[model samples]
Target chain A: MSESDRQGGEPEPEPERTSTGEYVLGGLGGLLVLLLLGFLIYQAAVVRDTGPELSVTVTGVETAGNGWSVHYRIANTGGQTAVQVQVTGVLSRDGTEVEESSATVDYVPPGSRRSGALLFSEDPGSGDLQVRPSGYSLP
Target chain B: MSATTDTEHLATGVGRAVGGALLFALPLFMTMEVWRLGHTVERYRLALLVLATVVLVIGLAHYFGAGPGGVSRAGYLADAGVALVVALLTASVVLVVLAVIDPVQDRQSALSVVVIEILPAAIGASYARSQLGAGSRRPQAPRYGHEVFLMAAGAVVFAANIAPTEEVVLLAAKLGERNAAVLVVLSLVLMHGFVYWVGFGGQEEATGFLRSFRNLTVVGYVAAFAVSAFLLWTFGRFDGVGLPVVVGQTVVLALPASVGAAAARLIL
Candidate 1:
């Protein structure tokens, strides 16, 4: 395919030629395109569109700076993506709400997980801790 | 020796296609916004996007493809088919290596991610096959309509490279009306400069300033804006935004896209 292989000062049309390798690669490529497109079509036909379903679980609590940080993992299990997800953590001491901390996750894609932390002056370990998704906007 | 050489030529063409896929699509593969978009984008939309990509790739291959069997109707078709395969396979491998998808567990997600990536990768493959391969063939001059389409394709590449990130939306939110208007003028000036003054290979014909600006640069920016809006919508960037934000984001993305459009004229 190099330019030097062709002769003369003017550009002569190269004779048509094909090798076994070209046929093999080309055939394989064609087959793959058909299969991939078919699969996507199948998915589009069968899957139902759904909105984002979000859930938050507290993973751990640690001392961060002057406060205790409540680390949480947020997951979206539905079809859509959740943007600006708000996760709120409440630490209650003896049935009284002592501290409320919340964090905002940028986005949580369906079937994916994102982690964030909330800080509170009172240690979550000293009280009954409850973490839940407050709200989220759709993308 | 001739047979071996032909086989080597095919191999080199395939190799360049692979390299081109990476060259164009690596940014999107690494972007977190795109990875999220894979699962979030509607299934039918993703499927439709695949079909659109197929059509665009075939058109591009007609101009840039080496056509291993010869530059005939069947030759470019074969080239387009191979470019699609190379693009898909290359995207799959790279996304997997980057842990962008877990094929076994995130099966639905993996499919969507690959589908989204296919367009840019396929275009890159076709471009590489035609332009970078040994004994590259010079394509015939593109018609006016084809020129606009090339600009749109270039816009897609540049816009896709950046649209998935949060910065577009954030930048739009902050750009305000005055800055956005300034951005529009800046994009036009930059596009015009690249096409006429930069002296890039295959520069636009130096028609009189007003005529060239009116015909090519202005039209190209409009095409870039439309392409940008489509891209942002595909990534769900327009889903929950106000009208002003939508317009602002479109203008922001049109900046890179207009540059790409101008570059396509010079390169493609």
Candidate 2:
């Protein structure tokens, strides 16, 4: 039989050989890539589960006679439950600090939200009312 | 030419493809996490849905035309481009339809917007890295390595961007527009640049000096965070100063972590 017929048609071309450097480098690179992926996945887990550290969202604020009444919706956005959540409301007029009032809540649970009020007497002229969530100032 | 050669070639190809896919998945997951954390669930859900759709379309393309030879550079780019265009068009149509139907601002819509805005960018960046090193010899090829490097870089960026501690402090300080902008830009550039340099430096250099330098960077970052916190605290004492400590801490951690990762990538 002819060589071509014996080989069953034309012989396939030889595949390109990969170099040693390429193989070694590629393998190392692949391993590093895997390690990086593992690290990232771990990082993502950390970011996701790291419970409510401290986060406060202001819902509304208003003014009442004789003093300024401020309403705040506070939540312990961190993972751990906070014992005391203190929120301080500083009334400012024309970029100047006029009066400040604060209120403290007993316990704030992670993922749970609550509202509180703080009143300041000294009139903060016409300006924006600013509320700050201070750390858990214990009793 | 020979059966053995064909088998070896096929094996290497499969290995690289699997490695690439896994590498790709890492950033995608992290990106999802960032979206989930930075925004509401509805937003995250919407983004994920869109992303899934994009992936499906790409999958379909591969199933039919590409046929598992592993996506070529052009094929990957084309798929990504088409997916992006479809996503944008779908989003615009949805927005218009919603607007016409009396404004759907439910969790879904909000989430959709956030997802549309974020995921595309993340996916696009990932695709770019993949295409850059499509057929290299290395098992981990520069492209895939770069992708991992980018993900690590991204983690740092995400951490820095949402740095609650710095944000809270800056806001409390009542930093003027210029100062605020400057602070953000500087932090991002310096921190990200540090990371990129370390990453690009390669493993050996990264391990030698960069590893030891990391402690110094961390210490410096902590000190910087403390100083920022102190400034906020003192300013608060005077009035008109409300510090956001959480934001500041986030920023501090992101920079160092990003830089450290880059350094590790470069040297070790």
Candidate 3:
């Protein structure tokens, strides 16, 4: 070993930069901000159709709380926003409305689809289920 | 620059930041679009918005008051970060309690939703000193450009609360072409009146009515429209919508935006 290694004054240790509290707080804050940003970047992108057309498509019939329920999806095909959207499902037999059930979707934005369940006293699958958009108000 | 992490500094400042978040950002929390934004906002875009908000919050802290005096850059950034965290936490808690964020809400989307909210939510945190302190308003005649910027900021805040939902589009749809035209004129007149006639905050400083209209009111309205239009585009209000619809929505949004601009001149 060199003679300097044996000497006590070989090197001086640097002063400790305090602010450990700030370091800890800043570290914690940075971690949270990054984590939040990471989650935002990782999430899936939601792409809805563009426009103001409201179209109702019946997807399935399910047994709900009562006799039966018609499950349907409402899509806004037009280019504007429709508010207070009301959908009607009419069970028809020989051109007569056997059972009518109506469901409401509070809002339906253009290119977005929302679903609702229309409960009917009669079996939804038993008759020709005709679902139609009843009414909607412009936002 | 809230550069110092002293115990007292943390306590009082944090409490005030929380209060600011609640007072200023509550409307955003209740807005349907903001809640729905959790589901609809693109992930990457939300990240960008959050990042931008971070920079903006830091700038606000630097300009307004990050620390008691002479805050460094680190302090400004750190203070903004803390304020953002507080705002985000507050929003999440309130939303969860309100059932706006249900168990079924996608965690990623919920995070994104809450993150995008930081845009306006962070305002309360960074502006707490000016908003809450008694007799502390130091209103000065801002430069013309700064005046326009304040209007834009106010407009953006108001627009953020309105544009995300389907209300603007719905309103556009409901209004007949003639009705929409009338609304446009009405908006312009109101914007002019708010500053010139109403004598709110900044309006009191204007010269004559015509000159004020030309120099301040007219300029302010145009800036509000421009800001509102930009917000409308960002909010997808123009997606698949025609020019007429766009104009209608713009008018609807501009009214609030102009009011915000006037308020900025008065308040900020």
Candidate 4:
């Protein structure tokens, strides 16, 4: 290192040119920041939530073995995140509860969805199969 | 020949930047809570964080050039821009490799994940390319305000690394009021020692033991504490907690953050 440099003195003169490419890159970078900030503000303004509003829907039913598997999706529409979400699926025949199963999702963030499946000995298609989120804890 | 040399020099700078980003962000990348926080953190706060990071990078790039460019207003802006790009790219690649985000299916989540990791990586990138690259230019001595800002930046880097974990909350709950007070005093003493006594690079001139202590050490600790509280709040650690718990958690995180502040003055 030069003595001047060692003493934290003035740096040795060197070319300090600002190339066209650097200008363009800087413009692009500034643009990216603006766009990202705009999107985030828009999202914040538009999306309103009181708490975690969770709902479950049956996406599909498939035969995995002697019985059938009920594929379900849990969606949280609220603003807050829910943890240890318990999604329960019930297959009832003639208003009598026949088979029931529940799945636990570790997390379901707001405006996000998680998928799981519940299996039963009876085909859910034959019975009135209902899938709904049973309960959840605040994250 | 000159143009070719410039291209080669930029390539080397870029290479070191990638190395720095990965090296600094590795802990965060592997952290499970951070992965979750990527998607769970409030959108507005995330946006503010990105803005803060941009401003910080520009400040850092002022001191440390991103490449061989001499210090100029436009040059530093461009350098800051390049560092931001390097940070984003590094974050995207690493998050994908770790399977933390599925960009194809989850664009918003992926963006959030990338944004959360960008700050530290950008700092590392700027620091590496400027200090580690060949033909490195020595940075100008920072003013007092910038020195404090650097301490806050360092505190953020260190505190963010550990804030997402459950341990902060758990430890705070168990620390009790007495131990918490002890920890606070210990943190202050350590910070004072590191600021003056420890033979770290860029050590501030000890005008007097009490003077430097009052100025840098006390101020730095306050900055670290504020930074710690902000980070914990951003991570939602203060969501449903009581005041005592919040204070304890802030104190817990402030310990490392204070050390980080001290170390930042020394190293950065």
Candidate 5:
């Protein structure tokens, strides 16, 4: 066979070589991406510091003919403002239901306390009262 | 190309598209299924049901549809099933940790909040990353991740509208007329974020942010939101259906579409 016919095709050009700087830059870019990912994770996990605890005190319990009045004292023990404070509780006597009520105080400033009363009709022979609070996290 | 080549190409493209769609839809469907399961059964049972349903759907899809011409079908199904299971497992872990540490005594709302709000967001993030090739060494992953982040950020901001408060008093004080309008606009932006992320993530291979954002998935969400709004206005519970419910429904619809897109992209 003729030499030209025997040869399949011309040789292809060689692939370009990457520079050391290019490789290093690529590696650095990957590292930066990884660092960004770590930062995102940290941001997601970090919880902002919430200020202050609100102290709730049951001031007094007074009995009347048909019902009893329970008094509350809500004090902000935190350095932040507390808004729309609602105290809820059930009054039980001798392990039986006496009454349930809630009181709402609009806003309580830092280092301040507010008092309110709620009345329940069923007489509690005499039992300790407990109060509970629920609302969005205080600002 | 030859007829056979053309047919093969068409099939491959369809397979890729479908796979992407399934990937995008799977997470959203799983989220809804979880929410439903939570309402009906115990947490353990809900987890079991989700797993079983996922396995069954994938197995059946593969068995029924995967054939000589359906290689992509089986692969996409598997991808979607795995994506959902991973997302759910991650969510469960997060929920368990939250419960152990914080112990939300009011389990109902707490569970609902996590399943509905937080889990979806996380899944959205992961889906975005996966699309962008963050989970793989593929060049497209970072781009996908960026797009996903943008979409999720948008959705999150939009969803912030419904933060529970004591009453309208708080709403009145905080959300003045101008503020409310701004919030509504922000919510729209958020919805767009989710749509763009999911839509782009669902392609056979992840595309650039602009391309993905303009895809059918994002368009579908925006369209659905608009249609739902129109529907509510015409025949919803108040004189007009409330915006909150409308937004919620829009999000719900968007979830499945996004998952389907992601699956399609991954599998195809």
Candidate 6:
């Protein structure tokens, strides 16, 4: 309807500003933020690729679903992220394996610990329960 | 210029840069690969990745304001440098907050991880104009150079989304040579069709298939391939891999990059 449209004109409704003043100020602020952030990062950390050199100790045992629940705590001694850490427990009486049970901890960071319970189908009152790390992947 | 306007504008650009840095690189920081990449990857490779990012940020400064230098090479480079610093700052802060870079336990590796994450984050910051800045750089008639830049920008944005993860490598490993080749063909067709459907500003009219093919399609594919190679190298997808593996990964990643490239011409 307007002359600009009829003539196929390029109409810029908002004036484009390419000012330098604001960028200078922003750049200074950004620099300060960077310095502060750098300082913080220099003092921060994350889980490293520490694997299954974990300490699995049986703290107690409780009776649960049709079996026994072996309570244990796993601590990562190695400096790596242990992903999908699975612990296997074998209940044996007189050197004969009775029931096998496994517990999984989604992730255990280096120098960190996770507590879980492994369920067994049979009672291990008369047997010695041996719990160890089955396997783990690096996170 | 009034003092008030100057301060306001300065805050605007800085805020956008920092916000853009944090927002755009969120996905990358969340990825486990990015967090530990610095520890496993070689030093020279990381340097190359940073260098490539610097080059991209230079061009990106045109749309995202780094200075008052309009269209000047130096200005773009300065803006890019600013983008890099902002991105680094943003990444450092977030890494610290998240405890991904544990300074007390492994300070060196944590710093390295932040540096690695900064690469993608800075690139994301360089794209603040498109992502956050509302009408900062008004679109004009697309030039050949501008079109190429847009394609590259799009490619970077798309490829960055997928490159840092192990999935790209896994998918590439699964794809056979024949399948990869077929996928490349499909990618080309999609790129060509995309441009036709969403015409880039100031695109020329070409009636014949050959003419259109030569103009937009070929150019887009070339840009896609170039972007793909750059992304693959940045993500360290090429180390200890043979030629087949490299090509397979590059092409697989290039599909989305090409589509992104085509979209860039039309969107910005």
| Local accuracy of candidate 2 as per-residue lDDT tens digits, B121-208 | 3333223323322222112333433434333433432332233233444453455656544664565455445643444444222344
Candidate 4 lDDT over B204-223, as tens digits, reads 66888888888898999999
Model 6 Cα lDDT, one tens digit per residue, B52-167: 66666766667543344334554455466667777777887888898777666555456557666765577666666334333345334446676777688778777777787788
Once fitted onto the true fold, the runs of candidate 6 whose alpha carbons sit more than 4 angstroms away are A1-139, B63-78, B130-139, B198-208
Better candidate number, 3 or 4, judged by DockQ:
4
Q: Per-residue lDDT for A29-134 in model 2, tens only? A: 3343334344434433554545446666666556788766666778665544465677887878878887778888765544556688788776444666777778
DockQ of every predicted complex: 0.31, 0.02, 0.11, 0.45, 0.02, 0.11
Model 3, which residues run further than 4 Å from truth? A1-31, A42-139, B1-5, B103-105, B132-141, B176-185, B201-204, B207-216
List runs of model 5 lying over 4 Å from the truth.
Answer: A1-139, B1-71, B99-110, B118-129, B132-221, B224-268
Scanning candidate 4 chain A in windows of ten residues, the lowest lDDT window is A13-22
Model 1 lDDT, residue B14, Cα: 87
Tell me the tens digit of each residue's lDDT in model 1 across B137-234: 55455578888888888888898888888999999989979999999999999999998998877766677999889988999999999989988888
The stretch of ten residues in a row with the least summed lDDT in candidate 1 chain A is A1-10
Model 4 spans > 4 angstroms off: A1-13, A16-21, A50-59, A76-80, B1-3, B132-136, B139-141, B201-205
List clash counts for every candidate, in order. 0, 35, 12, 0, 33, 12
Name model 2 segments beyond 4 Å from true: A1-139, B1-73, B79-113, B120-153, B156-250, B253-268
Clashes of 3: 12
Interface RMSD per candidate (angstroms): 3.0, 13.8, 8.1, 2.7, 16.8, 7.3
Question: If scored against the real structure, what TM-score would every candidate get?
Answer: 0.76, 0.26, 0.63, 0.88, 0.29, 0.65
Q: After superposition, how far is residue A111 of candidate 3 from its true place, in Å?
A: 21
Quality of model 2 by C-alpha lDDT: 0.42
Instruction: Indicate whether candidate 2 or candidate 6 has the larger DockQ.
Output: 6
Model 5 collision count:
33
The TM-score obtained by chain A of candidate 2 when compared with the true chain A: 0.54
